[model samples]
Target: MAGIEFEIMEHIGKISEGKSGWKKELNLVSWNGNDPKFDIRDWSPDYTKMGKGLTLSAEDLKSLKNVLNEMDI
Candidate 1:
């Protein structure tokens, strides 16, 4: 059977711009996919590249962001 591809999370924003080809940096994400959970990763560079990253709970993700933002930098 044929299946369709869909996005799991809503692309909220990117922490920074990536270099040319296969080198994306941090990304800000929100879940909107099937059985969604909080995730963090490079988001595959292309159809051939896999982005390195970690997955966290929505609460965890939010707390992490808050802590990072709270830093007096």
Candidate 2:
């Protein structure tokens, strides 16, 4: 299945700033040389109920913005 890809730097930044509760929401799929990938479906509370996952929460977006603002990103 085609999946969304995210940069590791961005991911770590989000984790550090609590922008995404990803650690609690999704599982990390790592590779040796290839870029890591994540299945958005895995993060959803109702994966079977819906065809796709929910968007990031407003609080999460705000937190992400705060993190990005604080850092050079």
The number of the candidate with the highest TM-score is 1
lDDT of 2 by residue, 1-73 (tens): 2453433322221122123332233323343435444423223232222124333444665677699899964
Q: How far off is residue 23 in model 1, in Å?
A: 6.5
* Model 2 C-alpha lDDT versus the unseen true structure: 0.37
Clashes of 2: 0
Each prediction's whole-model lDDT (CA): 0.53, 0.37
RMSD in angstroms, candidate 2?
10.6
Candidate 1 residue lDDT tens string, 1-73: 0253334445555554467544444433333444555545554455234455675767887899899999999
Off by over 4 Å in 2: 1-54
TM-score of each: 0.55, 0.25
